[model samples]
Target: MTDHPYNEMPRSDDNQSLFRPVAVGGRGLPGNLALAPMAGATDGVFRAICREQGASLTCTELVSARGIRHDPGWARSWRYLAITPAEQPVAIQLFGADPDDFDYAVRAVLEHPVLSSAFAIDINMVCPVPKVVGTGAGSALMRDLPLAARVIRSAVAAASGYEVPVTVKFRTGWDAATADTPAFARMAEQSGAAMLMVHARTRDMMYAGQADWSVIARVKAAVSVPVFGNGDVRDGPSAVAMLRETGADGAAIGRGALGNPWVFAHAAAALRGEAPLPPPDVAARAQTALREVRERAANLGEARGVRESRKSLLWYLHGTPRAAETRRRAAVVESLKEVERLLADWESSFFDKNGAVHFT
Candidate 1:
């Protein structure tokens, strides 16, 4: 495998404060490392795995507040909001354009026995997807600050009754030309948001280009509440660099955590001025990938689970020998048995005479 800078140690003094507990309303996270919510990736099973791997906090995929308002029985949104005890200190994220929808959705979540246990109710104003933005939700809210404030207030009012904190996640602005995170941070705080998470990219930038972390520092300066910096924090050194540079209370891992939950452990260790554990070997990666797929199959039916697991399996197999061919085979796997066989074959092919495995 190519050498990665994540394996390097970060300067101790610059990152000493990176691992402290952060308070959000009544909840206190054990550490500042959080697994940022990803819609298609962070399911209940994967959140549990991330938590075990060292994420101090995890969030569910963004659920539609309007959808929840319509499905009082949670028929459509249960899969997205499902949380297990193993993933405690988890947050349930909601997205919607209307204040009334958030009011209704927050109450419904608190009334439900299972979901009520979530550590916080996170409002999504960072998602840049066209479908979400077209509805005046997600990053579109950044363009309408007045409406965003009302939405935050509505959710805060609804959740405060249940003693649950309401947090907001947003981008710098619609684009670099209009970036104004400091102003948005103050408005959210005034609207009763208990904490803030700032993704340093604008909606127009989506996931491309370098993240301007200076925006996070500006937001941190504008708000008294805990703020997490999200964007491009892929490993231990990057996590420390974000904290040191932005003075953010935490670093939230989004795409960085895909198929590499160990990023959390490594970040935590680096924040504590220690060396990170070695990266997982081929055997361990194969086993964990198989376990995730099996658990997904148990929760969702086999067909859907196998279909959904393809991307994650490929992520885990990345950098292994013959990864291109293996990933091509993994993409068309129709059954769990086929997945198991594929992994076994790949693992067997990599082992040398000394029983050591090499990855490219």
Candidate 2:
């Protein structure tokens, strides 16, 4: 609602005219709101929802560069790279530090004809999880600037024949005490990265304290490529606040979009000076949950998807009226049919008179 420098940017449509794109690469990205590459959470199905909800840009979950090279099954993991024509301008995110391995992975992604339609391919250098960094991939690459720069230059060169731009997503640093976000962002820009996404927290923070918008602002100031400020953007107003405060060209939404993909549309609307709506009603919420579950099941298959979806299903139900009770009921669901049955019976009671999730 507040008109600030960040809120002042014109909202552009999807690739229609010469209007500046959201500036993902050296050019505009078309859609300003981007979906962050959450490991298990940002799969193809969920990405479809966020795209439908008005996210102009979306990224695949972080894929291992090493896996993409060593394992034939690696292509299977790239299932998240599956994109329909509707969701154009998607970015497939990859991780790993080995220059040779990264070169191979870049070639692998480019070989797929379907992936050519993407706006760009992003390298992830900002994951904090031990499993990822322990392999010297993800945010670990940040500590080794020479290797990180080499990876980007090499990936870009390998994918040079293709038109898709190459970008990087990274953290502030390992921790607050050793923050290198400002310096590294500049380095990536210098090394030919098309765009830079600053998560605004050091790896150590790991979604802990508030995302340092100031650092995001600093990165934006330091880099010429469009800098997308991420973290703590849980709703429309927060998106506006970050945009205004940091003057970032765009925002990358993560955990906030967990059970609420509508955030993309709402954020787009708010940036254009529109009113934000309340969270969806119980029926709508249930429908969304059902769709998400069904899609996950379809992608991952019923048995595995059902089991893997349990935690997300719980996240979707969080803060709903009788959510605890409903989740308790949902916990026993052993199959897709059971999940649907439980949701059907309990949808109505989830919304209170005030139109919020009921606690009881």
Candidate 3:
């Protein structure tokens, strides 16, 4: 273990806000680490947790542009775009193929009450999920450059009169084995993308195998906008390595932060050349799990939060002893009391040869 465990606490507001700020679309985000928007996760409460932990900014789960245009009241899509003051500098990411629908979605966001806090808007072009891909959206856009350009154009036009910065998050190409990501990155810039986040994988590759950082470097060299590298950035050193290796501007944390938001906290410190805090102990994990559940419950209400937080509660114990057994019990928990009991017991059993959740 490194001699310095990041145990850093809240510094003054002015100090934290200015620490290695990242520039996105002419605006400075508070830090360099951003939480990658997960489809089922990354709600308001979750976003807040990541920010509190040290992530400078975060994206909303991919909201469907077509769905929003078709039914503005669709709870699943538009509702995810919810932003708050504490989560300022948040970007709401949109997906879907219809350029007209994307226009509609952008207008809707600008007109919403939350418009004032909407930091930036991001377009999703890299998701490998089949349902999204089937819609000619997500990674499918990588293959259809013309349509991708059109949708991006629409988003840019819609936000043109406003101060909101428009961005894109996409994949390397349709094929991982033969990626032409640099061209795509240039296209995104020409199409008015103020910043770009590239998941260094191809469409066919899905989430398997390693992310190609070389593509990220190529993209960075080709574009003037800020480039945030995605895929395989699991911790501080890797985050730093991505920036160093690719010459990219920032690192967006995805599955690496599932159970450990501290990855963001540590990443913030690492980016600023400071020591990161130690990994959370078992007790910290249990408390955070409970706090997240309650916060989710508060934001999404009782039923939804309880249902949604179940997976997260289990995720919090990823490398703990008897994790497999506890994960099973966590899945079917009927009440908050049961969740409390399970986590409380798990907290008591934190002892292992090493203190961290992972042994590898």
Task: Give the top-scoring candidate (TM-score).
Answer: 1
Q: Over all chains combined, what TM-score does candidate 3 have? A: 0.89
Flag regions of model 1 displaced more than 4 Å: 1-17
The lDDT ranking, best first, is 1, 3, 2
**Candidate 2: where are CA atoms >4 Å away?**
1-20, 26-28, 73-76, 350-360
lDDT of each residue in 118-212, candidate 2, tens digit only: 67889999988999899888988888999999999988887777866889999889877777787898789888888888998889888899888
TM-score of each: 0.95, 0.89, 0.89
Clashes per candidate (backbone, < 3 Å): 0, 9, 3
The predictions' CA RMSDs to the true structure, in order, are 5.4, 4.9, 6.9
Give each model's whole-structure lDDT: 0.89, 0.78, 0.80
Colliding pairs, model 1: none
Give the residue spans of candidate 3 off by over 4 A. 1-19, 351-360
RMSD of candidate 3 to the truth, in angstroms, is: 6.9
lDDT of 3 by residue, 1-360 (tens): 112111122233323321356666667886667898998877777788888888878888888888788774767665687788867678988898999988988988887887546888899999888899998999889888899999999999998777788999998898956567888888889999988999988888888999998888788877778788899999888887777777677789999988888888787777666867787777778888898898887777777778889889877878776788789988988667888899877765554557544322
